[model samples]
Target: MRLQIGPNIDNGRVRLDFRKSPDRPQSTPSYEIEQTKADEFVKKYNSQEKKLFNMTMIFVAAFSMLGWITSIYKRSILWGILGIPGGVIAGLGVGAMISSNKKNNLMDKYNVKEVTKN
Candidate 1:
């Protein structure tokens, strides 16, 4: 394993290359096996995160609707009419975007498979 970090002096931007050499072993008795296991675990974790994010958004929408209903029960028509779907839509849109970006990043960073049987 090699770690290299440098700046492209001409471009004034930092570059990082933490690459395992192409000639490196595709599998090993222990270390490589552990890395593969870790990749699997990260995949599972990202999946669970996506599911939980969906569920939470559903609950938030329900809660917003419940709030609107309570307002209507109290005879506050304007807030009941405007706040419910607005909050729900905004919450879902923002949450979905943020969660999607983070999950993609996690998957990209951890899923490193270097071998395939032909």
Candidate 2:
């Protein structure tokens, strides 16, 4: 028996053919592995949430400190304290809005489709 080896471009799989045909037919199993679209989408969504949360926290702290600087410059500590709640509210609102929109977009894009029977 001679060994023949060549590439088959028709199918992505490498072909392994024998020089002599087998007396009995052979059955091979095939597998279909799915892509990582679902996992990737989830990971991306989580990453976005984490990043946004961290950024929001940092900005809130910075804005509050800015109030202290303003008070020092103007010689009034009470004004600095008054700016705290406003900074926090603005930070929280903006952060929540951004995270919510990103999460919603991801869910809409990667949500599994369902079939209903009437």
Candidate 3:
């Protein structure tokens, strides 16, 4: 069985697809859920994603500022130059980790998964 919870390509509405066989073509979706339920899931997901992105940007800004201040205090150009990329890398890493956990939790809550016959 395969379960999909995301936007539909045709109308951009959140859709839930449940298929008895994983090998079935995309054109055929065995079961479809109500719009309200799918919409709720999509709204939660999008909100979480937005929050993640905002937090990441905040981290980047904070790190960059901290680096700049340190460079000024230490009188080292290297610190200032390294700040931007360092901030970006750190922010992305942190964001990705948090995002993964949140998505997993959300999926679990919604009981969305794929099962294959062995």
Candidate 4:
């Protein structure tokens, strides 16, 4: 059996194709995988979330390091407290990301309809 998955294009739509089985002459139908607004949202949301998360984490780490260094030089712990909020935000972002990612993959979201070959 041959299987092909088309690229996701035009806002998360995919085309699916399958070759007939040999031992049995059963043929799988061809169909287009369409997306709902929810699908579009999920795709866009995941990507944006990743980008924002990374950007936020980078600044957080940088500030945290700066705070640590400043605290050490000044012989005071208060300066290092600046980095604590960044650490907390990073932890919360990680948790939110995990939940947002638990959705069906492309294959699971689609179905097949038989096409008559010319």
Candidate 5:
């Protein structure tokens, strides 16, 4: 991780960066076992991705409920009718974008490439 707080005087004036030093493992892993671990990691990542997406979606739905209430309180029938669906769609769209970004970050951190399905 790297952070550039100010101007790019010397490589963007890095404020903080963390790196792990190389350390050898005590026991050497067999080829078959390493492959199994990689498979498990993918399964975990996929399951976690679905969970995060659902959480974000429910949060947006709650926000839409609040907007709907406000529209009704203001006595704007037409606006309420239009705004409800509009707000829900917008909120969900934003949520999807944020969730996707987070998922990508997780994949990058784990150095795992997502397998595309047809």
Candidate 6:
């Protein structure tokens, strides 16, 4: 198993490559298996991420709306002003943490290593 971090214009991009033997010119059957597994894993991971993103957006909107309504009801502009940043920060932070942990766990399960360049 090998993980390659792209260079130059693709910096910070991690790509998975499967090879049975570096010296061999042809790929082995196991390479196909690894590739398929990786493909499926990527598809599942992306789907879950999309769902998480949508949920986070919803949460942020709801929180912001609630804050705005509360501020109006109480006749204070502070709450309304705070809602936008508060919602965005909280929503994105929690989403990022969850996504990171989930990615790490999935990588371990799939025997994949994440490599960083520089």
Which numbered prediction scores highest in TM-score against the true structure?
A: 3
* Candidate 2 overall lDDT versus native: 0.52
Candidate 2 lDDT tens digits, 34-99: 133434543465467568789778777777676666777777667767777666776777777877
Compared with the true structure, the alpha-carbon lDDT of candidate 3 equals 0.62
Q: Is candidate 2 or candidate 4 better by TM-score?
A: 2
TM-scores, in order shown? Answer: 0.40, 0.49, 0.58, 0.34, 0.55, 0.57
List, residue by residue over 77-112, the lDDT tens digit for candidate 3: 797788667767877777778777887788677754
Q: Which candidate is the best by lDDT?
A: 3
Model 3 lDDT, residue 37, Cα: 63
lDDT of 4 at 112: 30
Residues 1-118 of candidate 5: C-alpha lDDT, one tens digit per residue? 1111211223222111112224533432211112323445445545676677787778678768877887888889887887678778877887888877875675466554322221
Candidate 4 C-alpha lDDT tens digits along 17-94: 543455434445444455443345334434555665665566567656665666677775665665456555655565
Residue pairs clashing in model 4 are none
lDDT of 6 by residue, 29-100 (tens): 121114435566666655676776777777677766766677778776787788667767776776677777
lDDT for each candidate structure = 0.52, 0.52, 0.62, 0.50, 0.53, 0.56
Stretches of candidate 6 exceeding 4 Å from the true structure: 1-36
Better of 2 and 6 by TM-score: 6
TM-score-based ranking, best first? 3, 6, 5, 2, 1, 4
